[model samples]
Target: MAILILLTTQLRAWSQGEPPYITLLQGDSIYVGNSIALQDTVFYDVLLKPTIEKTLSVYNIISLRINEFDTKVIPDSFQVHVKVRIYYADSANAQDSIDEKTLTVTYNKFSTYEGKAILRLRGAHWVQVKVLEVTADYATLSAVLPVVELENRMVINRDFYMDEEDDAITTISKDTTTLEDCQELKVYWTPSQVAEMYDLEWTFIDSSAINAGWYNTGGVKDPVKIFRNNASRVRISSDQYLIPLLYDGKGALYYRVRAVQEKENGEILYTVWSDLGDHRFTGHETNLNWQATTTFAEEGKRKSVVQYFDGSLRGRQTVTRDNTTKTTLVAETLYDKQGRPVIQVLPAPTLSQLIAYTPLFNVEDETKEYHKGVYDTLSGSSQYCSQTSVPFSPASGAANYYSASNPAAEEKEFQYIPESNGYAFVQT
Candidate 1:
């Protein structure tokens, strides 16, 4: 890799009064393809590890510029051509002409002239600038060309295990399995040339929505990092029950890997983070217990009621009519004692008595009957009622049924279904 230094120092003679030559100005040495450094030189030549055997190394000339020089007599025009020849390290007779390109430079006396070169391919070879021709008088040329070396890229692979058996990896196209069965995870990557260390990090996501605030906001912890001692693989185990049980039911775990290369001179280079690998963990067997309250306007009064239930049973009900409120608990008929269900009974108020004092008790008075017996006093005739004679009822029966106060708390029993990984209401 050639270092580009911006011309800050005054122009100095390359040789005593031999027309000060121009060289590389300011620029950093760039790694070719990989993140490792195998050799160190002022301008090091990079050796690319080809994916296939018997392949040639490819080179690209990113940017070229003329550095320091005396601008007394500006050259009208100058031509630059790169000559690259490849030869086997074992035999000099095995030589081949790989690349040759002639570039025209727009010369400026006071400022630098930027030029671009076409890509070239050569197998373990040497590169040199051959001045094809110079067009102006007293137009001497001095050039500085940097050689860039590309590094070998790395790839990561992952596998999962449960106990001593290897678990089949789950993918988007594959069916999801329970996480309770998995106890270990392994992540590995192909070793990169010039890489001295590797860094791994991972995090867990509880839902599909990405919480940017969870990662960006203060007080949030960073992802867990695991360093490897130049090893190509790492294993993580939750055998001791280190993995926390997810109360939210299910979640996904994501991980990233990167290679780190440090030069002997204390210079550090890092590869970008690899693509994210995600694993979904299911089989959250915890019971859910919650209560919901609903409120509605009735007879110029706001009425509210609450219903509570657990995973296996409906537990209680509470009702509020205006300022008065009442609660009824549905006693469990059976209790689990050491896996044995024992029968028990506790006396509690019935549903009718609980709402008797509330506005719900007057629901029947507010309801209207649509059908009526027709008897005209003026005509003194008995007949079926017409639409006009029929009592008008605003579909009040359905609404009144829900509004009626009940003290006997209803109970619903749910059975867990392993195939669906959920519960179903079996009896109410």
Candidate 2:
């Protein structure tokens, strides 16, 4: 019964004529002479019949794979050639063809030949493989061609926050005069194509080193630190970062971003790091003060008064001795954004006017005298003397006599002129 079964199998194989060729499609093994029908005609089984007949009339064939096989008979010494041709599904016109290949075979040694070709199928396309001619023995071949869409490319666009101050002033310099305070740093990117996550790498260097050309000369190099954001975004604060302040006179932060994507095969793909973004500290605030001496005469007495002037918060205050009397005079001035005095808070005396009623006091003896001057808004001293003007009390006998009852309190304006080591102010 076993021998009969084997003979029957051989007879069935002989009846098929051509050697068996198998193709793998979506992990399913399909052989020639068997056709798979679907709603959409994707792949079809082609049989090499004596008289070719039209098969399916549906979708296009995108990809195919044929397993390698061997010829039943071996050639003595000559070579065999095989050729493959691809064509449009609906037409007999050929799209592509592979030239014939010579096959090598020997007695008692079976030789096999195989070929494969993949083409991106459009609306309707198919492939055909055929043996052109055989000098001695017949050869079998197989192929696999998959139609797939290409992956989309990724792009990264980064933005760095340099200056978020109210003035929107971005400082970029190595000079001490240009130093400013920066507290927060932010960075974000776009076009996260096919990325499941992202990573941010940051580093910093002292501006002093850069100023001295350390980078160009291969001096100390800063180490990079990486942070996995797991998303295409990040906002770094002062606590999370050790960004240097401009007040330190030598700090700069640099950063870069990259996209990560995972594949079905457990492989990961990373996009190239984005261009480096940098922020540098440039300028800071400084405190300054100075003193000036002046002589005041009143009631036949001349007294030298030393005045102290200090600048704070875009304003200035002057403290000096009242002229003619041993009293004290304090004047506070407020400045606007344009550095012009907008308000003046002059001292009002309660006891000075009443002193004239005393037996030794005379009404004519009260004389107003201007001693020290007020500073212009945002004015400072350098190394030389700076000329500044203040609201001065008119001469003793002048029509405008500044008294305690009528203080010379009015909005005064001045312009600061830059000079050597100091600022010269002129009343405007």
Candidate 3:
């Protein structure tokens, strides 16, 4: 079977096997305020209960409850506009505010979801379902049906084609055992005719050296660690993968193929981050054990850090059919660590919000990135030891955005200025 490995630092509940009370699915949360009490809308699921009337299609009665939340401190009146709608069988009822009151210090979204309806507060983390009554056979609930979260995981086939001319290409299987070296793999993929829709890259590797190759990836005398025109491709497609690179070069290579636009910054794209350098040409063709890994970072860097550290890398992809646009490629990521993600430190970290919003003038790239480096005099001057955001490009209008140099955070705010029909920033 073909596999795509992804790594991230986000916390998600995956079969945690928590009690029904603590086990919250999509659309769920506890409403707590640090101010006065307020009311918020909620949603629930399908339930079978004795309605005041007879059989009314798929419907249930929603109730209103008022209470204070855990937080909602002084001045900040903790209140939410409560609305309830029922979703049964297929459709949902019109949105209606059942109650509007102060924050009720309690974890409510849980029961709501358990009961069936999902809840989503304006600008909140998740949506939850509202629980009304649950019987062995039937369940009744009162909540506004909500949009489900996007499931963007995919199984990819990374193959190589002879050239863009031929349509028939052989898929490089991952189960061969011939231990050897295969060089100069040729592959082709059309961005126009897409299969399942995803991003595509031609090169991949397991990991990189602790602190090496920030400029060019593969080249002699090119100390900049910059990549060649075609290092590799991070891609996705509905058709199978076609590869011709495994015929001569090393057959054993680590390749990470995932869906395009399916990952967030700081999310792990693949696994294998120990002490190995990025292996661009480790192709083992005959054995079927073809594995390749890639390393990403700046020069004078210790390791490749996460692109953007969102605590959790997995995120929602734009909802579209499986055949839509082939795929909308987003930033791809790969992790070489173990366990779930909660925002681990990248090999080379980046800037935080402090410097992101900072103002700058003149620049080529709209965003500026900072890294760990020496500054000031050898004496006890203002030289940062670990991480700091300083002037990267000193040219006039050269620095537009700010970066802390932390790779995981992908940390840098854009200077969005309305241009003609699009927005332009000094840095992006």
Task: Compare the candidates by lDDT and give the number of the best one.
Answer: 2
My TM-score estimates for the predictions, one after another, are: 0.21, 0.20, 0.19
Per residue, candidate 3 scores C-alpha lDDT tens digits across 261-283 of 21223332321111112234443
What C-alpha lDDT do the candidate models reach, one value each? Answer: 0.30, 0.31, 0.24
For candidate 2, give the lDDT.
Answer: 0.31
Identify the superior model by TM-score, candidate 1 or candidate 2. 1
Best by TM-score: 1
Cα lDDT tens digits, model 1, 297-390, are: 3211223333334446544223332212333332322223232333222222234313221222211235422211321212334422432222
The C-alpha stretches of model 2 lying farther than 4 A from their native spots are 1-182, 217-248, 263-267, 283-428
What ordering of candidates by TM-score runs from best to worst? Answer: 1, 2, 3
2 or 3, greater by TM-score: 2
Candidate 3 minimal-lDDT segment of 10 residues: 316-325
Quote the positional error of residue 303 for candidate 2 in Å: 61
